[model samples]
Target: MELQPLATFRVELAPVLHVGRTRWGDRRVIGIVGGSFSGPRLNGEVLPGGADWQVVHEDGSASIDTRYTLRTHDGALLYIQTQGVRHGPPEVMARLAAGEDVDPAEYYFRLFIRFETGSPDYAWLGRTLAVGTGRREPNAVVYDAFTLT
Candidate 1:
C-alpha cells in the first residue's frame, strides 16, 4: 500500500502591516496600531489556536479576521483566504519552519495584507482603489505591487 500525506490545513500568524491612512494629500499619516482584540485579558482564550489571536505588538499588530486572494509562486493567483499581512523578513517563514528568531529586515519585501471582507474596498489601495478584482476575476490579476525602493 502506498502512503501519501494529504495537504493538512493550518493557520499561522501572517504579516503585521503598519496600517496607515494618509491625509492632506499624503502629507500626514494617521495610523491605528491596535485592533478590537488587543488586551491582556480576553474572554475567548480557551478556543482553538486559530480562534484566538494575540496582538504581541501594540504599536502594530492584530489578530487576522480577514482573507485574501493572492498570487502563488507558480505564477497563478487564488483567493483562498488569508489571516493578515505581517512585517518581517523571509526569516519569519524560515523561523516558522525551524522555530528560530529572524530579523524583520531580512525579508525582501514587507508583507501586504488582504482581508476577505467581501467588500470591494479590499481590492486596491490609495489611488489604485478604483480598479476592482471583480466577481469574475481575469486570468491573471495585474498587481501594482508595492516595493519599497
Candidate 2:
C-alpha cells in the first residue's frame, strides 16, 4: 500500500502528572491543553481536556496511548485515538526526557492512528487507517500523519 499525506499535528501539553510505577510500568498522564492541525484534507484546532496516558516499560520504551477530539474548520467533530511506541538509546531518551531539542532520528517514535465521527462529511475517516512519525518538543509533541491507501 502507498501512503498519502494526511495532516500535521502539533499538540500542546501541560506538565506531566507522574503516577509512579504501577504493575504495568512507570505511568504518566500528560494533559492535552490545545493545539492545531492542518493538511490537504483536514484542518482544525484540537479541543482541550484530552490526555495521553503513557507507560514506560522496563526496557525504557514508552507505550503511547492518547485520545483526543478534533473540530474541523467546517464544524465536524472527530474522535481520535493513537497507539504506538517511542524508544531509543539511553542517552537519546535521556536527552528527550530532559527536554532537549534532539533530532527525531536519534530516537524512534511512531503511531497508528484511528478516527471516528458521526458527521457525514467526515464519515470517510471512520474507515481510514493512518500512521504517524512523532517528535517531542519541550512543551508539545508534533507529528505528521499519513493515510494508508
Candidate 3:
C-alpha cells in the first residue's frame, strides 16, 4: 500500500486539566479550543467543544483519544476521531510538559486518524484509512495525516 498526503492540521489546545489516577490510569483532558487545517483537497477550521481524553500509564506513556468537528470553508462538517499514543524518555516527556522546544524526533507520537461525514464533497474521508505523525508544540499539537491507498 502507498500513503498519500491527506491533510495537515494544527490543533490549538487549552491547558491540560488533570483528572488524576483512576482505576484505569492517570486521566487528563485537553480542551480543544480552536485550530485550522490546510491541505491539497481539504481546508477548514476545527470547531470548539472537542477534547482529547488521555490516560497516562505507569511507564509515562500516554494513550490518546480525541474527537472533534471540522467545518470546511465550504460549509461541510466532518467528524474526526483519532486514537494515538505518545511516549518517550521521562526527561523528554518532562521537557514537553514544561513547554520546552525539544525536537520531535526524540519522542514517539503517532495516531490512527479517522473521519466521518455526510457531505458529498468529503465523502471520500469516510472510506479512507489515515495515519498521523504528531509533534508537541508549546501551546498546541501539530500533526500531518496521510491516507493509505
Candidate 4:
C-alpha cells in the first residue's frame, strides 16, 4: 500500500500538566489550544478542548495518546484520535521534555490516526487507515497526516 497526503496541521499546546508517576510510569497532560490545517481535500481549524495524555517510561521513551477535534472550514466536525510513541537518546529526550526546541529529526515521533465524522463529505476518513509523522516545537506540534491507499 501507498500513503497519500491527507492534511498537515499544527497543534498549539498549553503548558504540560504533570500528573506524576503511577503504575504506568510518569504521567502528564498537554492541552491543545488552537491551530489550523489545509490540504487539497481537507482543510480545517483544530478546535480547542483537546489534550494529549502521555506516559514516560523508565527507558525515557514516551507513549502518546491524544484525542482532538477538527472543524472544517465548511463547518463539518471530525473527531481525531491518535496513538504513538516518541523516543531518542536520553539527552534529546530530556531536551524535549524540558520544552526545548530540538530538531525533530534527532528523535522519532510517529502516530496512527483514526478519524470519525458524520458529514458525508468527510465520511471517507472513517473508512481509511491513516498515519502521521510529527515534530515537536517549544509550544506546539506539527504533523503531516496521510491515508493508506
Q: If candidate 4 were superposed on the true structure by all CA atoms, what would the RMSD be?
A: 0.8
Model 4 misplaced stretches (Cα beyond 4 Å): none
Off by over 4 Å in 2: none
User: Which prediction has the highest TM-score against the true structure?
Assistant: 2
User: How many residue pairs clash in model 2?
Assistant: 0
lDDT over C-alpha atoms for residue 130 of model 1: 14
User: What C-alpha lDDT does candidate 2 achieve relative to the native structure?
Assistant: 0.96
Question: What lDDT tens digits, residue by residue, belong to model 1 across residues 1-149?
Answer: 33222111222333333334333111211112211111121111111122212232333322333333332222233233223333343435445335444443443221232322233443322212111110101111111212121
- Give candidate 1's TM-score: 0.21
Q: Using lDDT as the measure, which candidate wins? A: 2
Q: Looking at candidate 1, what is the lDDT of residue 16?
A: 31
- Candidate 4: worst-modelled 10 consecutive residues by lDDT: 35-44
Model 4 global lDDT (CA atoms, 0 to 1): 0.93
What is the lDDT ranking, best to worst? 2, 4, 3, 1
Candidate 1 vs candidate 4: the lDDT winner is 4
Better of 2 and 4 by TM-score: 2
lDDT per residue, candidate 3, 1-149, as tens digits?
A: 99888778999999999999998799999999899998877898989879999999999899999999999989999999999999999999999989999898999999999999999988999999899999999888899999999
Stretches off by above 4 angstroms in model 1 are 1-96, 116-149
